[model samples]
Target chain A: MNTILSRFQIEYKPFRLDIELEFPNEGVTVIFGRSGSGKTTLLRCLAGLERSSTGYLRFGDQVWQDESQNKFVPVHNRPIGMVFQDARLFPHLTVRSNLNYGYRRIPPEHRKITFEQVVELMGLRPLLDRRPQRLSGGEQQRVAIGRALLTNPQLLLMDEPLASLDAQRKQEILPFLIRLRQEMKLPIVYVTHSLNEVLQLVDYLVLLEKGRNVASGPANAVMSRLDWPGKDWPSTFGAILTTTVADHETEFGLTRVQYRDQSLYIPEQPLAVGSPLRVHLLAQDISIALGKPETPTSVLNTLPATVLEIGPTDTPGSSVDLKLDVGEPILATITRKSLAHLQLKPGMRVYANVKAVKMVHEIEEY
Target chain B: MDPSIFDWQPVWITLKLAATTVSVLLLIGTPVAWWLAHTGSRARVWVEAVVALPLVLPPTVLGFYLLIALGANGVIGGPFQSVTGSSLAFSFAGLVIASTLYSLPFVVQPLQGAFEASGKTYLEAAWSLRASKWDAFLSVASPMAVRGYLTAIVLGFAHTLGEFGVVLMVGGNIPGKTKVVSIAIYDHVEALEYSHAHWLSGGLLLLSFMVLLIVYAFNRRLPVHLS
Candidate 1:
């Protein structure tokens, strides 16, 4: 669905968060940024909670805000569900009543998602009768999510939904959220700073820095770019590669993946053929090979690639990072001794001997 | 003890006067106190000073001015007499008016304290939730400030009940009409009837203490925080 998301440009006294962003209207569009990078402020502006914001905001056909026209829809009238970092469940309300409160507010004709389905989706059936004060942090956040979903909002805005939970609680609720994303026909704008969440869940990425749009595109494309804020190489920081499982080598404890007429192997993983997987390649683990060597090596994935770019090394003997454009972008870190030995140069064909293609996780496709 | 010597009419008149006075004070005081608490205007301090005038003013002086203003020959009372065919002074209604004036601070102070304790956040939260102004006030602000309303009621009623000098000065001792319990007790002592005075004093003491005890005990049992 070609749903039109707004371009937000807002300025407040002493601070300003100005960025242009287009939401996907489906799946999870993560506004990934560090804390204090104006992620929450941007979400609040979209929710109409920050009325003083001067900008144009439109979700599909509806106009939430237009400063020149002096038109601004208040928060209650906006058909957008917002889940805060802290859940913000009314302390005075029971879980069932809290869910019902929002449900009762929506017009009868617009109520597509039922209360029972929402409760089941969030796994909140047992805690329906309990008050918010009695639930654990994770359970409370789940109830908050269920409550928002039952409202049948046009879009859901989650501002760091898992930030408040500990590691164990985050693990507990993440699968439920993934299920919600897969099953529900809801478009979500999920804001987070955690790289793990960005790697696992995001389909569309809107990277913000200091109130400015840094990069925006599909998750894998944007995340695989070198020369990003901190790192000079994609793998030096983090690299997400899309690959499909080819076969499993059970005796050798290896799983094979086919990419560009090459069979690559990772540690034994539980995955099926045609299942997409994202491998995290560390730059330090990759060694460049100018010529194909006929010798036994412990390394698994070795693919022939053309050099795209190279950067200077920090130490005397350390090799520069060579940018290799493959099915997805990859980076190779080689020593100056190895670089001279292989005679590596830009646009020259070389082999990237990957020591390991760390099986990050199997990205469940929607 | 002795019904004839006791003059039960004065005791009954006093109860009626206190009840009427407390009701009038509450009706007038609530809105005024609410405004004082909510308004950011510099004039609030001036209004507050006026409300607290009874606390510092000598009862006889206040009573004298009220008497002149409502007396048969005075400017307001003369016009009032021509319109209503009755003077304001020396009447049961006059006793209520005087008692209300003396008890204004007791009602207003407690109400102000209660309102301040309730805070503005509760009202704002309700407003954001799409509750109409009236709905917000009824459902949120009023319930949040309930302790203040209770305190206002109790203080206003008790202060009116105990009024003596102001009521006597404005409301001449008309035995069956204007003579309240305080005036009745004073009359008993002036006539050397200690038994009748003792009975009225003991009854008022018991009633005031009971109201106070109820207020404190009920407040203690409330789950929500109180002022």
Candidate 2:
């Protein structure tokens, strides 16, 4: 199988990390969770950084670790590249030599990436001769990424690679990551706690909660699922609407999308028609109506959706969450009073007014 | 210029003893410093204190115990004599052991400090890039901790070069065997040979000053992270 299979169980003084996960051998598979949830611990186990962990970790047909059989491969022997949270670049080596250190270690036959290619991809030409200490955090991380890529690993592991950067630096680094995801065939197993990273980068999503795997699936499917096992809700979750540009209105500066039997509109972009786009719609931004509005409304678009379920109200006077089927699943939340007045029921069709899209990734991705 | 009043043998002996002592201390002290820097055991502080005892105790006090220990009837000296059929007290081999012990903290402490400061972050980064454990340490860890190595080497060598009391108690004033420069200078001063004392003392002072100046100059130019 073209997958990375891992099963690790380890116990610290008062904590334990137990997981069995299969990461697809393509695109970015994000192992996401809140802090202290063993997200990093899991990544370390895959890298063989945590030696005491037992059970098996198999990458494709090769078994990297199997405790019962006394089989284990050290971190350096595994064909995996890792990017840590902080840019732990070598202080003594210049950026060029830091990139070369790993590149020289791998034999020519296994070096699938050239030095020039990595330097170009990571935008490292200007910083090659400079010491790592002189670069900004983002630049250091870029060099860190470039250094790892030159090693030509089969699998790349990223442990919160952008967590150390500020908001602006994070934005500066995101496009490079997106391009890497789009271009590279190497499977990337990324660990992160940022929901924005999950929304923007993840192709496949694995949710970890308190040292346990709570949910695992495609990013959009997992994001739209309402009944989250942990309290990973509120601002932490949102529906990921994967759609394509059906048409563009140059005069209005908007792009139209056809979802199911209805259409929606997004801000105009310089994207070709039929390009893949992912939109972020929070539950609060979507409101449901009983009938299709014929009156003039400011809302840009409305879609037909069948109510699959109504979530329980957390407080007596709070809003009720709704799960909708609009070709792809999306979430909506309305106040309890509104729910009673409309007399909503499961399987009943309604019109969804998408007032605002929280964010959008017009990224060229699957 | 009589051989009885003037000799270059003491200078050569001191240089040889210091060089040999530093080499022996480096081989043994590095592992100990590495362990102290990385290990989390509760006994670390105690072990560190014992290693630093020579730094605080009077050379005479340390030499007193070593004197008994290397004596023919003492514990180590008894077995050593039987194995080698030679006495350790007041000998060149005995002088080397004294200097290694006295100069140990100078070698180990700076190295320990460096290892602790650099930590394992860069090493792990290298391992991720397919560098083996030894390669990562040599390429990543050692270079980052280079200032520590430099400090340790200079202090160990200079400290051994300037030994006076410990050598006096352990090796004594045996010509061609244990009459190091420090003792020789003292002998000259006692004999009121002012020129001989000034020449030896001035050279020792100048050599030490020059070594420190070079190290400090080089430290500023290195690209090592202070943290």
Candidate 3:
């Protein structure tokens, strides 16, 4: 059974959040956007919190909103869970009680996930008895996630769940999120402005700009597009690669991933064989050569790729975003000076050298 | 000294008056304060100002108006007496109503502030979890703002315990029925019974301080960052 949440040109007055999109029945669909892109508003609309002037919202068999018919489902009746940017935990409730609050709301028969399982999944065993105020920020967010999960929601809406956390905290909580995706079997609409958030967890990307969805496709395909100037920079720009760990060398402290038969070694991760790892190769870190350059001083990760297209960097930087089709279309950033030195062009057969592969995260998926 | 001077009727009447006033205030104040906390109505400010009139206006003005409206042949008293066959003036019920009005701001303001402090996020979370609005209010919002409710109750009770001008104007200082502690203290001093005045005044002073201490002690344990 397909769970379809279709929006027929949603419009918010004074702000143009007009977009039509279909979300799949499974995994995480990241709503990637810059700030003020109406991603959160879209999630709110889908969750029946925001009533658009005209839109059609459906989930599987249930019709949530049909503006023409004046049919709108209230937020309380909708079977969806949302985790806000800050952990919106009930201050009066202990973590265990907060989670149980959701569980009790669902009918006894409708509850598919048990309380203990949620506690274990979110690593909330220690914090179960503590109130939200007593927990750390990261712990509070985890409790919030657990609270949402225990509801057994049909679709989970996360609006930048990791945005409030520091980098170290984000790293800490991401694995639990991956576990939720893999084990819960619930579709998620995750809204985030951070590329790292999208790269680590998302299988699909709905790119939004100025309240409009600019692009929508699978994670790698959409991220690798040369048109977006984000690809040329390393820190903020990159493509999310959906590849599995093929092998790992413990002695060299590198884990090999089969990205279209191109063995790439990243910092060793404790992932089992066939474990899917979403690695984000920063655009600036990748340099394209016309042919496989033999000058190597210990950059072990190099792959034969064909340049698909080149686009200008969105910033003042002279670097260009290049789409390379190896296993999947990956984006590489090269400076204009380097581009001229190598005489690179679209459709040119080139070997891309990744100085260091940063493994974003690895989580088993259903 | 006359033994009747030390008669405990005024003390008993004072406790009864304070208890009745606080109970009525809580019952009427909670929902109104909750509405004030959540309402986006333009008239909310007006209503809030009316509730707070007792705080800014002289107590005699409030008492004088209430006494006129509730007295025999007054606007409410004529019809109320015909229906109930009892004048509300110079009665325990009159004292309760007067105290509730006098202490309305003390109760409602703290509760409103507490409700406002607890953001709409918790309500949204509860609704998204399929809890109805009422259920969310009871389970999430009420518990979250419990500290404010406690503060309101304590302040309302203490403020009622200390009321003088309103009780005197509305209740008319009848020895047993209408006499609250503060009014009784006033009557004792007027009669040159300094010791009797001291007893009632000192007791009320101790009682109000104890109420404040208890409120602070209880609230100290609550999460300060409720939002």
The candidate maximizing TM-score is: 2
- Model 2 docking category: high
Higher-DockQ candidate among 2 and 3? 2
lDDT of 3 by residue, A1-366 (tens): 475666745554667778788767678898877677788888888887778878898888888898889999999888888898888888777788889888898889998898989889989888878878788889989999989988889889998998888877888798899888888889999998776655667887787777776778777777676665332223224566667888889998889898877788888888898998878787778877676656655777788988787776466868777778776788887787887787777788888889878765332110
Clash-forming residue pairs, model 2: none
lDDT of 1 at B137: 61
Model 2 spans > 4 angstroms off? A13-15, A53-55, A244-263, A267-276, A290-292, A313-315, A336-349, A360-366, B1-6, B71-84
Q: List, in the given order, the native-contact fraction of each candidate.
A: 0.09, 0.96, 0.80
lDDT of 2 by residue, A1-366 (tens): 988888888787577788888878888899888888899999999999886546798899999999888999999999989999998888888999999989999999988899999989989999999998899999999999998999999989999999988878887898789778877888898998776754666789998988888888888677777666656545325577767779998899788865555567888756678766667777888999999888889998788889988887775657878888877778888899899999999999998889976454332212
- Which DockQ value does candidate 2 get? 0.83
Candidate 3 lDDT, B97-149, residue by residue in tens: 88889999998898888888986778999998889999998988888888888
Ranking by TM-score: 2, 3, 1
Alpha-carbon TM-score of each model against the true structure:
0.71, 0.91, 0.88
The window of 10 residues in a row where model 1 chain A has the poorest summed lDDT is: A229-238
Residue B90 error, candidate 1, Å? 9.1
lDDT string, candidate 2, B25-129, tens digits: 989988899899989899999999999999999999989888899888878788899999998989999999999999999999999999889887777988989
Error of 3 at A201 (Å): 0.9
lDDT of each: 0.76, 0.86, 0.81
Question: Residue A296 CA error for candidate 1 (Å)?
Answer: 4.6
Best-matching candidate per lDDT: 2
Query: What CAPRI class is candidate 3?
Result: medium
Best-to-worst lDDT order: 2, 3, 1
